[model samples]
Target chain A: MLYLALGRGAWGELLAKVKVAAIQARPVGGDFRHPGNIRHALELLDECFRMDDEVQVACFPEYFPWSGGDELARKAEDLGMYVIAGLAEEEGGALYNSCVLIGPDGAILGRQRKLNLGLMERKHFGFSPGRELHVFDTDFGRVGIGVCVDFWGPPNVGRELARMGADLIFNPSFFFIFREVWHCLLLARAVELMVPIVAVDVAEFPFRLGDKVFESCGGLSCIIGPPWRDLDDFASWWYEPKFNWILGQLGYEEGILIRELDLDLARELRGAWFSRLLGREAPWP
Target chain B: MLYLALGRGAWGELLAKVKVAAIQARPVGGDFRHPGNIRHALELLDECFRMDDEVQVACFPEYFPWSGGDELARKAEDLGMYVIAGLAEEEGGALYNSCVLIGPDGAILGRQRKLNLGLMERKHFGFSPGRELHVFDTDFGRVGIGVCVDFWGPPNVGRELARMGADLIFNPSFFFIFREVWHCLLLARAVELMVPIVAVDVAEFPFRLGDKVFESCGGLSCIIGPPWRDLDDFASWWYEPKFNWILGQLGYEEGILIRELDLDLARELRGAWFSRLLGREAPWP
Candidate 1:
């Protein structure tokens, strides 16, 4: 079992502030097997890097490409940033929906396979579900990744990650429809886990096979922090419009959203609200 | 351990449609021990019953009254309606934050003491938390109640109720602050549990103790149903202005919200989305 690294080492000290980006990409023209899909993903990654030089980490939509993992790692190494990208992998004759975490050193730090499978992934694509959850240690802080439906599962992969000492969670989803539902679910997860969430989905995707045509993934990448209020005036924190702390959000268009998150604020709010229920000590610490 | 009654019997056959009401009341002048608080709650109940004659079940906010359980039961029996009301209870020398269910026969069918407690409730009020989760079989269907923070808990009492065969869940909340957070959590619970949630909070409450003048418990009582889309076109469901199926929602004012929920639609969507993950057979069935 891969648990979160909880020791008060350099990582703990580095949990001050980090700039994160969620990249909303246009759908690749071809399927996962096509080289065009990988090329398109690389192009989007390049755009994200060019858009924000201060982004310490960038996340892409799910099922971008597994073949592009090494290339993404190399880019991360060159830019000195962490990269979380989604792809489908073939391991031991079984296909799995996965996301790869590449560190600043351009090393594949870890991979999180999707635990819950949709009907299309299971019956149409023959993808096997994942069995384990892992939290990765990074230069900035401990992070966890839940690919798409894993965040929607009743078992709550995000809550488990927070319990393991993850200050941040990244959800790479292909929400396709019901965009409002996606937003509501992400906010709920953030509040329950008492952590920050960077969830990205494809802006627009058109699936055409035989006589069927499916379009509109509704790309609305957003970043949500823990619920907080003004310490002195509790009423002002909720009534005042300025206290609405959705750091950044993107509309249904191909773009990259960058925001500097105050990890200290999230920590303070978590302590005030959830420390009693979740406990104060970090498991690994 | 209590599980949802899932067998296909007369109850299953009766799961077609039910009219429900969520009453958003203004805070009574006195605390739980005051007669004015009970009078205010009874008045609100009268108004709700008058507003919707066909409503089979009605829900009230948390801490509405402590002395009206018997009266509320008698009223429910007279009207032939199920009533779920929130109040504080003193039992065996312990104070509990609780909600009571009154059957159509005017009997106190069951009570759900809150399982989670906040700082004010635990420290200032010296209230002890409840230790059990239950689902009640009513004339309409299986229903569960979670007072305030239990709906916000990570374990998700709402999901447990849905698993226990509850077609509907009532969340009696006194969400004094963070109104948007309340909306997000309610929508998230509805989507995750695949069940309708009728969450009621005080319309507006002003507390004046010494120099502290605490005002505003924004009332935005709402009823949310299962996530659904048009079978012909998926994009139409989200993009169409009329597709937002929040039956009704109130602003920051005292009012009653009534909606007719199609349980058959919820059951269909649950079978389509959650059955694969949660399993088709109910444990109790």
Candidate 2:
């Protein structure tokens, strides 16, 4: 792991460069079913690897393959990649909407359950909210997950994760409403936390359920990096490539978005930014 | 008062429409001095009122006329408009950077001191971070102020104010760098809190002190409203007027930006949006 635990408190070390893939695939749960959805996601993952063999992390959208966690873990072990995907887990007579992190060794590393349940998830699906937030350590850096609205809503889980020293945040969302607002939020979260965000959302698709038709307003899966370290690099930070904080993004379509993230820069930025708040000297001049 | 506090927890009522003015003026502290900056600000306020006679609230930038609270309050009483301005406060043998809210009656309503001090503030000036946060009630609505970097920094005071039932927020800034990031943050704060933000920044100007010249990178004062309630109002929310969440804004020049804010719509949106998360029906279908 890039971060090591010292005696009193843990200090972070410079992280390795990470090649990440955010898969914008069709919905895996609800009327779409699971086994087939899981198969499709696996196929997409394989395709992503073929395109970029060095991809270290692969993220799938929320509720994609909402079950069948074992399959994802097995795939992670086979491909020697970190697999992050949303799952619907049943335990203690309660169902949870969760995002699970499967390690390269086929171990279920950990899971961050959705803390803020949405209206549909509460009223109709009877989903219970998660209690604790967790950060998982990886070879590249420490990472945290906030499922869908948990990242967007109040008591933002992303903020908590960033405060816990996560270098990067993964948001597995099955989002549909307010794309513009969501875009602004993603940027805001990246800036506020000083951490890059790997947000993957399910692709748009219409489905039929016993004469009722519903369409998913998913897609806009993106990888947003932290803000610029040197404002002097551009005359106006909002113009041209300077404000291009969205490192890589996919539209409302089914595909994979890949980007090589400099976790070292992100970690350094987060450290420098927070340290200054404590009346410490910033690393930059 | 537009909102009456009921028993148990305070229940909010719809607020009347309010016309607000955000004055973007030159720096008033340090080399610029006190009474001169205060005079300039008052003249700008008069000019704003002349432009929009019904302007009910006037906000000035941080540290501009940083020590003239009495004059601003008296002017507020004279104009019969609520005045919000930044002040360098001396209390308990400690000097603090604070924003004061003065009612139309010339009464000092409340003040929110800077909770997170900047490096220059702590090291160069020996400023102390404030211990308390406050919200002031007026005829239009309850409001909160976050002075400069306090609103932008971690443990954001703006978020706390919004959670404390502030219908609107005022950010008095003397910002110089990373304006693009600041813009995104303002919009994000508005959306996160479900409250509008009236952010007034000092206009850009150069000042000389002991043979050294320092220029202010101020301006970009803006009024950002809450996100649109209806997404279907536009085909693509990111395009044109829909994504133009910054209702009114000024460039890096000394001027006053005034706009009529429908606090009733803001209150309604906030209540409905939060209620939906708690499994209640949204007002809109």
**Winning model by TM-score:** 1
**Ten consecutive residues with minimal summed lDDT in candidate 2 chain B?**
B6-15
Model 2: per-residue Cα lDDT over A171-263, one tens digit each: 888765555567777776665566888989888776443454445467799999865654343223322334577888898878999998887
Worst ten in a row by lDDT for model 2 chain A: A6-15
Worst lDDT run of 10 residues, candidate 1 chain A, spans A276-285
Model 2 stretches with alpha carbons more than 4 Å out: A1-17, A27-35, A92-94, A123-126, A204-216, A227-244, A262-265, A277-285, B1-15, B27-35, B91-94, B120-126, B206-216, B227-245, B262-265, B277-285
Model 2 C-alpha lDDT versus the unseen true structure: 0.73
Residue pairs that clash (backbone atoms under 3 angstroms), model 2: none
Query: For residues A151-259, could you state the per-residue lDDT of candidate 1 as single tens digits?
Result: 7555367768877778788988876455657776776676576688898887766655444555655578888875453344432443342324467889977788998
Give Cα distance to truth, residue B260, candidate 2, Å: 3.6
Instruction: Please report, in order, the local distance difference test score of every candidate based on alpha carbons.
Output: 0.71, 0.73
Backbone clash total, candidate 2: 0
Lowest summed-lDDT stretch of 10 residues in model 1 chain B?
A: B276-285
TM-scores for candidates 1 onward, in order: 0.84, 0.81
